[model samples]
Target: MIRRTRHVPQIASSEITPETVWLNRRNLIKAAAAGTMATTLPTLASQTPDLKPLSYVPGECDGCAAEEALTPLEDATSYNNFYEFGTDKSDPAEYAHNMTIDPWSVEVSGLVNKPGKLNLEDVLSGFDLEERVYRFRCVEAWSMVVPWIGFPLADLLQRFEPTADARYVAFKTLYRPKEMRGTRSFTSVIDWPYREGLRLDEAMHPLTLMAVGLYGKTLPNQNGAPLRLVVPWKYGFKSIKSIVSIELTDQQPKTSWQELAAQEYGFFSNVNPEVDHPRWSQRYERRLPSSLFKPNRVPTQLFNGYADQVASLYTGMDLKKYY
Candidate 1:
């Protein structure tokens, strides 16, 4: 049977969160003002120097599940998938602050009309940044709700004016050897300078975002500071972090996961409960901050619960085949 994603009503600010949690956050802010880190702050997080909270306008599903409590700031920042720093969830938050992002540049080439290394500042100079609260579903069956700040990726891609031959968008993560612990791992399986891709259409979708911050602040290094992709409908890995290159091409680019184990990882990697991972079931996800005794398993939603907006993009393709 086919399932349709539901559209929740616009939640009023008054009904968005429980009074108790709000009070708790309020108190935590007070503590932060007194030089103590807020309890809700992500673990091992470091404040980016001279960075201020970014301003944003809400998206279409602005209040999606607004009534549900957000994952604590500490947990989201401390836990991560940044293998560059290390494999452990806490590795990024602990080690990422050592890396650098200032004066960053992204090389844009391949089928694009304008091809050169563009400065990150110039790219977002006059763009209107916005905040989008999205459900983050990982292939590992753990999830979090994140308020990402950025503009639609399409807005940036359009600047290059993709040619007719540009059918796919490829991205590459930064490669810093001495500074990145994982890069020097002799026993690691992942290739350095991680790569990812999306079909041209998916890259241009309104829902696709190139995020620079989260929780209204400058993005933490561990969370792909400076630049990252946010393909909400796909598993978290699809959103490559610390992007340094974006290549538009007609031929399908080789993604890191696919190169490592094509049988296990696909190019699409869309969130589909009906399809199970090779070693585990994808039907349910563990809401994060969960411990051993309490798994907090919740039914996984199709397209990470954005099927209503993105399902049409797949048309006649079989998700299982592509996924």
Candidate 2:
């Protein structure tokens, strides 16, 4: 079950380690031993065998246009970890194709001058979709390079004309039990209609994209088809998929992951290795395309390596506490 912390204490930046500053490409390679991982992992991992000894040698994180030789389309689309369809990584790709999206519409409400519902077509009527290659880092210690196509989220919020009172933006995912029959997980700890949010400034950041497509083609159902938020700096969960409702509010909204396990999944789920998870270290992550010999292991970056663009946003707040 999802656990919560009794209290969230605020700490000083002085106490916080600069885990994101270093480059540990060599350290990870040093620990790359051929061995089998015999452990019952989180529900987010693919439902494949639990004890597979990995073997392979991985290349370093290197590429152009903020992307690293985009994770092959096959792996990107097939090896997904979307729990809405099932706990298996391949569940989304196999099951989500049946999900509906053409008749979709997103409801905009709260702290907006013109709050109302707009069909998907109306939302994309005039906005321009740009292709941006971004590094996608999951909280599960894994990473991928993706070429996402979408426009700045600020463009959509501006259309509704956010009021001065709008301080945070909250988003919700679609919920259709009947359509996703295979995902009716009774043992699941998460609540339905996964929720996520961002500070007003973060939402307005040009780097924050509302993706509608990937790899030069339309979005696949498993990948949050129709629309999804892609915040590269933060962990993957912050980028809520298949958005159904978007609302602007004055107070920070309670997000799904944080609500599920307050201590494990903090509100500011930043890619900070210094602040370790209760169960594991966030200091390292595995870059995909793994085999028996090369289960890639590398040092994780602060803001997922985009600290140059987003580090300033949390000027005064304690990331450890907020997290």
Give all candidates' CA lDDT scores.
Answer: 0.83, 0.77
lDDT of candidate 2 over 1-323, digit per residue (tens):
98877898679886763332123323323323322113212212221111122121121222214746678765777777678898788788667765677799999999999999979777555577677788888898888888877778998999999999999999999988887744488888888888999999999987888887777666777788778999988899899999999999999999998889888988778888787888888899888766668888879988888888888898888888877
Provide the TM-score for each candidate, comma-separated: 0.85, 0.79
Q: Residue 264 in model 2: shift from native, Å? A: 0.7
What clash pairs does model 2 have?
54-292, 55-291, 55-292, 55-293, 55-294, 56-293, 56-294, 266-323
Over 4 Å off in model 1, which ranges? 1-50, 61-67
Worst 10 residues of 1 by lDDT: 42-51
Pick by TM-score: which candidate is best? 1
Write candidate 1's Cα lDDT for 1-323 as tens digits: 99776987677887775443354565546657877564435322344343457767766543333334678776788789899988888788777877788889999999999888878777556577888888899999999888888888898898889998899999999999887998889998988789999999999988898998888877888889788999989999999999999999998999998998888789999999998989899999998878899988899999988888899999899999988
Over the full model, what C-alpha lDDT does candidate 2 score relative to the true structure?
A: 0.77
